[model samples]
Target: MRRSSVATSFLLVSALGLTACSGGGSDGDDGARKAAEGLATALAAAAAPADGASTPSDPLAAVTWTGTDPATVAKEYAAVIDGMDGIAPSVEVAEVDGEADKPTATLTWTWPVVAGGDPWTYDTTVALADGDGWAVAWAPSIVEPSLADGETLDATTLLAERGEITGAGGEKLVTERPVVRIGIDRTKVTAAAAPASARALAELVDIEGAPFVKAVKAAGDKAFVEAITYRANDVPAAVRTGIDGIAGARQVTGEQALAPTRDFAAPILGRVGPVTAEMVEKDPDAYRPGDVAGVSGLQARYDEQLRGTTGRSVHAVPADGGEERELFLAEPAAGKPLALTLDRRLQTLAERVLGGVTPASALVAIRPSDGSILAAANGSGTGGQNYATFGQFAPGSTFKSVTSLALLRAGLTPQTQVQCTPTVTVNGKRFKNYSDYPSSAIGTIPLEEAIAQSCNTALIGARAKVKDGDLADAAASLGLGIDHDLGFPAYFGEVPPPASETEGAADLIGQGKVLASPMAMATVIASVQAGTTVVPHLVDGVDVSVPSEAEPLSAAEARQLKAMLRRVVTNGSGRGLADLPGGPVIAKTGTAEYADGGTIRTHAWMIAAQGDLAVAVFVQTGESGSRTAGPLLEEFLRAAR
Candidate 1:
């Protein structure tokens, strides 16, 4: 029962005098307060372990009971809260009251249900009599005011609704969707037939049979061991029929957080499932067995904000078949929605453009105006890798754009003439153009024409025009090497300063050691189109600061770069995208060579900017950027139009 502070104080003063007279101690007020405090300390010690120990101390050893056995009362008290997930209460002496022979101490019991939550608190009084010293008067009311002799407490968790993941314009991306949980219900079949049923169900669901059989054998007699979960409509008719015929197979329908399609932005959006053992071990307060949580991607990164707070309640159930009464309750709070800058329609279109690609590939698109990432799609050939924003590969001739910027900053203009030779050599290493380089375009030509034809020799020949770190500085202005928090997992391309002249020459054509993801290449074109440095972002409302060390891109440089790129689409390798549906497309195509397994392989790359959208397409194995990645870019531009 709750009493006002004034009344509690008055009761304590009256009880202190009574306790002094009843031989609590000879020192009157001080002695009585000390004795009462000692009793409170014992109650606290018995409530829980000291310093996070697993086992709680015995209450019988801490208290002396009168007219009742201490062991029996302690056992009864332990059983009252057996179902509370090992939660312990904080018991402290609130006040002392009553007469000379029967002084009472009110102990406040507060139970911790969840981390950082308001505790469940209530007051219960214990009688104290001087049998030898002060002995606790044993009764059911000492544990709780309303706790009867035969009632026990039970705790139940109330799960909160998971929040939705929204795209640009607040359209729901990951939300509640119907699903079928396929499993083996062991109770429906005899133990002898369970293994055969599990194997049959596994084969019908396309899972391995041996593992399913082992799992079925290990599960409890009444346990339901799940094999897999699929979208409700995705389960095949034949598989459903096979499950129904199996001895113990069952299907349960439910809703879970899911995207529009299984693969729609999967690597970025992630998925939710039962918490793993590692997750529970890492933060036992936040997760428990059978708890569903985000396991990967944005879902895992923002799990605390998206998973919401789980509510808990303790009910007092009567052993004599009476109605249960609530002792504590904490209402669950729904999770907050996470917003992203992705354009669902554009993202879906980009994925479709690469649907037929058989090599590891990626397509990334961005809005240069605001630096918002519109789409990041990976082809099936990527084998579940997030190559769109994290793949690090040689950018090939597309890096000519960064080299051009370095040369432009060093006083070389588009009109300046340079030789586009068939081959160039540095440090005894001969470098030649791709096999399909045009014979007519190979000769002394303007720098702009050299870029339009993607002349590797022309750029390498101009390596002396800029010193070391010049290429990296230029790449940084185009958002290649510099890292940003971005509020998500992303890999910025790397462009370290060359260690030697030969390496320097190779760096100019984006070869030696330069590496970039599709997102970084997309940002390069986006910067040129925006006329300023662009930092690509996926999650909404995250502050991505530009590095102070990076030289800011100027309008004049972007304007000249944009013109050279436009000429490529109109007259050079990117001519395939010249008739794209969108407005005039400024583009660059690249083919980089790398030795794989003692054989030569090439990475195809193409970057383009059309109207407000900038796009990059990359194929891990291809003939050439113009032939491989350019067509995908053109298809996406047309569809996105």
Candidate 2:
């Protein structure tokens, strides 16, 4: 058993009066043992000084000092171990043994140095004598065997190298990159000049100056208040010259984890900087003030794996200019790399294609061959949200694919004729085709032609053939409406059973309570291209389990769905993709109307599968899918090819 159990049993025996000097020692020996145990308890409670809190005046108060003043000894002991992070150690009396005239006690001290690390354990002996009373003989070596009277322990931290985040083919995505920290160094200027200098620096950096001035005023006398950090190449020469002219302006070079460009997958990869107070409070042993840690996104999700162990070295420095000896050392460990399934080139191209789109747009690409997510790009208008995998909106006519599947399972083939009209009504609610529905394809036509032209009334007219849960079941087969943990932030969308007749009619056109994300729409195309259900994933080595209750998509059904979708590109709203260079492109186009603050808006959506690539493009506010989102999708597919 450990020393704590032994100490507890000893105290229990004494409390129960079960033992009386079993070795036949004198009363003085018992008194010495009791005094040593009391000293151990105080030592265990003596924490190191933190946040300017004063050290305990006497941790050995229970044991009277015979050879030295107790207060002076206590003060010296606190000074020597001041650098050990003020962690209270577990101290216990290991044993008490000696001649009757002079007794000695061995104390076990265990210091918890790091999280999940081996503790520093040691044993030291303190002698007891009868000078004025049963007291302990004080010496500097009682705390630590190697300590001298005037030596102090100095702790030095060794920083660990943060790991890189790698993409497909082992390409480094997030890695250490050079940067310049521009700030106001208060040590170089008077207190009155610091705020002015901060304002000037902020102006030169093109940042707001008032907040910088306020922060500089609140900082310490010699603190360096950082205003901004810029990539080494991004800093302008004019800014550098202006900084040199300022009295307190300074620029410090450093390295930080960064992507290829400023907005390249920023919302997903996250960033790292100084550790916050909340992080320290959450895990005091793992974090401290001034430490750099991950703050958001995947960087925060796998922080421990990315931020390796920090090494430490404790040295005994002599006060009389003697040689210092190392008491302990722990070597720093480098963090492991986080692997992802994204293709860097494809992701860059996707972001570039969506660069001009406004109002929360997203483009997601998945490889149907293996279900690997190749790209998930958010447009500049997203306001820092990861809209590619999380944006929820009506999918519009793109959801007709699910309706087609439900009808196919209802014994309707691709060539089966369905009535195509200008408008259809359900329960006094009128549903009609898009504004520019071609007059050539409007009468009675095959199911494939109705899908190609995106006939809303045609699908709503046939909704009576399928039952209540048919849409949800068909959506599950196409990889929608089922949630899976893909080891990252994602929204798989919702497809519920229709609650009323109007809602059921609206379901046929992908509106009225139907919601889907760009990633979810991309997965639907990937599933059709794969001839089976496909689950998209980004992080490598993460297991994903698809729901077992949903009916699996058969190869025959996928083939029939692909045939109808191909006709969509050949003659329907998806005609924009007809001239692409890639081998056959199967696609669907959607334009769903929504009310935003009493003003009507439409969500433009386009999804297509070309060769092994499945892509989905969505524009929150657009006129039509073929006109707004179709061009961007074509550009990305052309570049990717």
lDDT of 2 by residue, 1-641 (tens): 01222443343333322211222335555755666676665555343332332323444453466667656766776777665645446667788764555578888876655545676678888887644445667665767778877888766666688889999999999999999989988888889888889888888998898977987897766578888888999988888788989988999998888889988888888888777768988877678654677888898888899989877676788889699898777777888889998899999999999988877899999999888889999998999889899889999999998999999999999999999999888999999999999999888999999999999998999987999788999999888998878889988888887789999899888998899999999999998988888888899889865679568888889899999999999988899899999599999999999999999999999999999999999999999999999999999999998
Q: List the global CA lDDT of all models.
A: 0.83, 0.82
Shift of residue 312 alpha carbon in model 1, Å: 1.6
The clash numbers for all candidates, in the given order, read 0, 1
Q: What is the lDDT of residue 53 in candidate 2?
A: 28
lDDT of 1 at 321: 71
Error of 1 at 593 (Å): 2.2
Candidate 1 worst ten-residue window by lDDT: 1-10
**Model 1 over residues 1-641: C-alpha lDDT tens digits?**
01123323333333322221245534444444445655454444444434443323563554556777757767777777665655766566688753456567788877777656897889998776754456667666666789888888877777888999999898999999999989999889889999999999998899999977987997767578888889999988888887889999999899899999999988888899878778987887788655789999999999999999988888888988799999889988889999998999999998888889999999999999988999999999988888999999999999998899999999999989999899999998888888888899899999999999999999998888988788889999998998868888888899987888888888888899999999999999998888888899888778866777679888789889999999998989999987787478899999999999999999999999999999999999999999998889989888888
**Which residue runs does candidate 1 get wrong by more than 4 Å?**
1-75, 97-103, 127-141, 180-229, 235-253, 320-322
Error of 1 at 38 (Å): 7.7
Q: With candidate 1 superimposed using the best TM-score fit, by how many Å does residue 159's alpha carbon deviate from the native? A: 2.3
Off by over 4 Å in 2: 1-28, 48-63, 66-75, 95-106, 124-129, 135-140, 180-230, 234-254, 284-286, 318-324
